[model samples]
Target chain A: MANISQPSQGAWTRMLPNSAAAFHRISALLTLAILVIAFSFASPAFLSVNNTLTILLQTSVIGLLGIGMTMVIITGGIDLSVGSVLALSGTVTGMMVKAGVPVVPAMMLGVCMGAACGLFNGFVVTKMKITPFVATLGMMLIARGAALQLTGAAPISQLGEAFGVLGNGALFRVVEMGDNGFPRVIFPGIPYPAILLVVVAIVASYMLRRRAIGRHIYATGSNEEAARLSGVLVDRTKLIAYTLSGALAGVAGNVLMSRLITAQPSEGVMYELDAIAAAVIGGASLMGGVGGISGTMIGAFIIGVLRNGLNMGGVSSFIQQIVIGFVVIGAVYIDQLRNRR
Target chain B: MSQTLQAAARFDAETTPLVEMRGIEKHFGGVVAVDGVSLDLRPGEVVGVLGHNGAGKSCLMRILSGAMAPSRGEIRIAGDVVEMGSPQDARAHGVETIYQTLALADHLDAPSNLFLGRELKTRFGNLDDKRMLAEARKVLATLNPNFTNLKDPVSSLSGGQRQVIAIARAIYFDVKILIMDEPTAALGPSETAMVADLIRKLRAQGIGIFLVSHDMHDVFDLCDRVVVMNKGKLVGAHDIDEVHKDDILSLIIKGELPTDWRPRNLGELEAAR
Candidate 1:
């Protein structure tokens, strides 16, 4: 009996290759390749190392938030509160640093503040059983109000130089700065913070796809009742996914403040839309049980290029919004098509 | 003749009952789904539960597996009364249920699905991919050695492969009692045979199984004892050797054994139908 069953099981394993993972990867790669080709044709500067690095630098913050968005979406949830959390975290981080608090501790406090806001959203969505869309929407309003009230609706500037350096500074050796004499391409000019984006993507993808906790996220999204029946802590996984998303958004907010040298109460308004768009474009199903960090990273870059390319081509900001709107719709349509099977 | 000898070989000589449920009752919004349903699952015993739709077979299993809270009941594992307020509670008490849908995440691979909801993480909070993949191979080898494509996502697997993963997951968790709901409902002949072999192997390992199946041939082929329920009430339990297929069907549909029931060969039963 063992011998008979062994051959049959081998036949079972030989018959199929588990196409969904491959399909997911292929879709992401296809999107990346298309984006690269389109941008390359649209502008000569798009392929240049300096401009490419600029896109990477610009996408870092969105990429950070996109990782969290991917996890949340994978668990069949959303975090509309991210943008508000970002602004609030930025306000607190900026205030603390400006008040002579140490930079590291202040950054920690800012992230914690974002996590706390996420906890509220998670508790409401999970414990209270509110729909994710509505729960996070309420959180979005509360976070926005808190930011406005704390800063009196004003942009706080003159943040410490240390914090500013984290956003804009890159470790590089300047060979020369002359326009004609050996135009010095700054060696290792990629922003250190930009590397942080790549690292975040790799780590987040590993956790979501490879780990046991990652499997739970997928199971939870696939069927909440089944997952709970399989001994999964369904409510806890959701809470963690939402909290991580908010915390990442907060980190993105700090990165923005570091770059701009100010904590604007309205800095990240509507950024949640961009983050969600990135996750969707990267193959995350709005219904859940799909998505990864690498796809989201590419998605963030695609958005950055769309915005930057339009700007460089002299398109008005209003037109940029129209283009982004069309792109988001097109991406979601393609996602629906891919999901039809 | 050889198959009957092998079938008898499937049951361990020193079998012991692993899980028992008594007086289990569950209700949903003024409707009594399960009431006064009791079952005993012994090691190396495949207990076939037959019932019509809405006859509370699922509700009874759900209460036993802790998927739903029972308004009143006692579940015991190894002679100790257990309260399964949630599915996790049942799991901790060594109970696992595999639903008809398989409940696998289509986007994830077999190893990932096998370890869903209880992943092994490294001390640094990273996924231990190598360890997980290795353990997946080891577990599938022991439970269903024919399963080999550990890296493939579940959606791409055949019907049999998916079922194998679901069963492997239950076995991997060291579940002493396995409850399967309509496991072979949609499989082809070859796939169904594969599942039958898996069930036999699980029984050989001293695991008790409560199989909820509509297939009478499956019950005769795999089960040691048959329990029948009709309209949320238990009819009776009979050892397969003492009763025949018609006797069990009569119990399932009519809630009692037929007065003139007699055992018949599989070919004769099919011919009669």
Candidate 2:
């Protein structure tokens, strides 16, 4: 019998092919850097503390949505109903508040409603054996119709000051001197939405990197038949993934409602596209089993930076939409190139 | 060593078989895939199952491994009958199957694949990655001492390496009966030899193995006894020393017993079936 060598032990980084993942992250960083440099030259305010904070705040809602999208995509599934769910949940919260319900309980119910909708999507996909695209597409229409019907196709305004504070309130204040030696208004209070985004991102990163359920998600996405044969409970993993996505969408909706101080039934229209774009840009594979939360967070920031930069550089909104579309295509193309290697 | 003498030996044998499948039958809608087949696997024995493409060898083995339920049969492990509702049920009974496709997640590393569904957990219910890796390394060392790329995904490894991982997964869980389907079908000569050596080691440890293969030489070299099937029916079972290459080949192709063959208790066995 051959003597067994001392088992090699190290961090997971030592186990993984560092170069490939590094290359993807480096390319994303380079793109963000180039954009930052070019925008700093175009708009003097681009690097200012307030503007940077503004970019982060802008990314928070979509970033939250992207976190959920990343998990769904990693499991080889897609959700087209998140945007509609967001609208519906936000409308429900608004209607509850108008009916004298406490803001906290109303928000909790909205989040639960989102989870219920997600569970419904999961049921249709797993139990009814429907394709995720078709099932979620049906849910998208159903949720949107519900949102409109709840509010009579009108926006809900006059939300109380206490509720609005959750979205617009700052965690702390920052004071800085301006060019003229005068006290400039530079308040870098942490946005509540940004704080929630960070918390969700951290939890998602840990779950994907260090948990058994996370490993099962990757395995199921890689090969469903193999996973089932291995006793991986493929259907349960998918259900949890979709349900988590719905809850996050509800959270994003609450943030949006709070920020606007009103709940618009049409508030989250086409937001799913942006969320998907962020996940894809973060190096998530549509085919599944290949992505990370950090990459997705970076992807969300890139979008936020690009929009903010273009808006400050006096670019037209129409042209900005065209540019964003091309960037999504470009990001997916780069992802494909990486995968081929 | 004639068929009649082998039947007499079976009647006198007193040791209980590790697994017994009596009158096993499987039907897929209008097609009868496996019909009234009985097989007994003894401990520490390698039994090679040989058949043509549609002879139902794989289908029958699938039933044994709990991937598919038998239409009509009782499966007894060491004389206790058990229901095999799923692969998990079979594993609980210490039966493991290494499928033709290997049934491994290509994107996961060896250790992750080794504990795919049955992971080692800490007190807090978190995965114990360190312990799993150490155990994976230790188990793999027995199969392939030179296998050091435990961290790379199975997709990056060679075909033989992937096979090693799949086999390791089955053995790691303390399997009593292992069903390997075409294990060496895609392997090179050296890899095939490696698998043969592993099988020898397993037999020494008293594990019963069911080798399903199309390769006649492999069956002859590795199996102590050979069972042949044709048209979803057992043609004959023979001791390796009692049957020649031509005898097994003719039985497989023509689906007929040899002209001079006679069973000691053929009528009794037929009545039992």
Candidate 3:
């Protein structure tokens, strides 16, 4: 137990992702570092302490979602219902708070709402034998419609200021003072959203690397029939993957609701695509069975850093989307090329 | 205590067969895939089953391996009646199978594939990866000393190397009755020889092997007895010395022993026919 999590042997320590995947993992890391460095040079404001924290906070939402997407993709399944589930969960939490329920429990119910939507997606995909793309796509519409109906298409913006603790509220402050006792380079401190993202990332990575179910997820994705024949409960493994994905999306929704201090039914539309892009750019294959949480976090930061740098460099907002799209395609292309060689 | 019983069981193959399947039948809708048939294999014996496509060989083996439920049958392992509802149940009864597809998760490395469902875990139930690695390394070293791609995903391995991984998985756990479907169908000469060596080694260890094969050479070289099936019934069963390769082929192609065939001991063959 004392030696738990240690890499004991040499070649045996090389571990998962194989050699090519290891190369891809490192390449992704280098890509993120290069983005941060290049962006810092491209815009003088990009390297500032204030802007760096902002980039991380902006990354928190999509990065959290990407964690769940990575697990689903590892099993060769996709959860397109993430964005809608997030909106539905957030709306429920906001409504509960507005109706005088406690914030903590209301938020818990909000996250549970996301999990319930995900559970539906799982049942539809597994018990009903529907393909994940179609199943989650159906869920995507169903959750969105539910959120819209509940909110009557109006955003909930009047939640009390006491509800602000979950979003932009600082947990620990980091600030630098000038010689005249005035704050010179003020840091936003570590916000609630960033803290949530860190906790989720650590748990997700630990599960992926150290759990039996995690290994089963890889096996089920790599070759499902093989996993089934090996006595792996394939259906149950898939159910858990979707549920975890939904639970994380729930976490994301609460973070976003906290950040805005409002629940907008229209919020999180197309955010699913961003989450998938982050996982893919981090080296997860759409074909399934290849990716890591660390890579995904870096991938999210790459997107965040890229957008911020572009904004400060006076680039058109529309060009930013085009650039991110190119990066996603290029990342997959490079991975395929490595495999071919 | 159980090890002693297993050791005693290994020597008494002459008295009790390791696997006994009685009145196995499989029906698909109105069609009968396998009619009433029985098969048995003793410890330290290798039996080969041969048939053309759709002759119900695969269907029968699927039931025996716990991949499919028989419409009706009794499967007895080590002289005890057992109900095997899944591959996991079959394995618990000491029956292990290697399919033609090899059934490997191509993206995982050898150790992960070897312990797919049965993983080594710490006290907290997290995967005890270091211990699993050591165990996999130990078992694999005995199988293929030159197998060095332990860290690479199985998809990157060669076909022979992949077969080694599959075989390692089957034998790593405790096994009594081993079923192999077309072990040499996908391998070249050297790899085929490698699998042949493994078969002989398992037999020497007192494990019963049911080799489902189309290759007459593998049938002749490895099996003590050969069984042929046609139209969902046992066409013929023969000792390797008492039968010719062509006779086995004719039984597979025509589902019957040739009209002018001679039998040294007509007891088992005549009874089956």
TM-score of each: 0.84, 0.90, 0.91
User: In candidate 2, how many Å is residue A272 off?
Assistant: 1.5
Please provide, for model 3 over A1-341, each residue's C-alpha lDDT reduced to its tens digit, 9 standing for 90 to 100: 54653544433435434477777778888888898888877777888877877887889999989999999999999999899999999999999999999999998999999888888888988899999999999999998999999999999987877667778876667668888999864557777788888999999899999998889889889999899889999888889889988988888988898889898888899989999999998889888889889889888888888888888889998999999999999889978867664
* Model 3 chain A: lowest-lDDT 10 consecutive positions: A9-18
- Candidate ranking under lDDT, highest first, comes to 2, 3, 1
Provide the overall lDDT of each model, using Cα atoms, as 2-decimal numbers. Answer: 0.81, 0.87, 0.86
Best-fitting candidate, measured by lDDT?
A: 2
Off by over 4 Å in 1: A1-50, A98-100, A173-188, B1-16, B118-149, B172-175, B197-201, B241-247, B256-273
Expressed as tens digits, the lDDT of each residue in B115-159 for candidate 2 is 999989888888899999999999999888889998877887898
Ordered by DockQ, highest first, the candidates read 3, 2, 1
What is the full ranking by TM-score, best candidate first? 3, 2, 1
> Candidate 2, A153: how far from true, in Å?
1.6
Point out the higher-scoring one by TM-score: 1 or 2. Answer: 2
Candidate 1 has which clashing residue pairs, if any? A9-B146, A10-B146, A18-B153, A212-B119
Candidate 1 has a TM-score of: 0.84
**Given the true complex, what DockQ would model 2 score?**
0.58
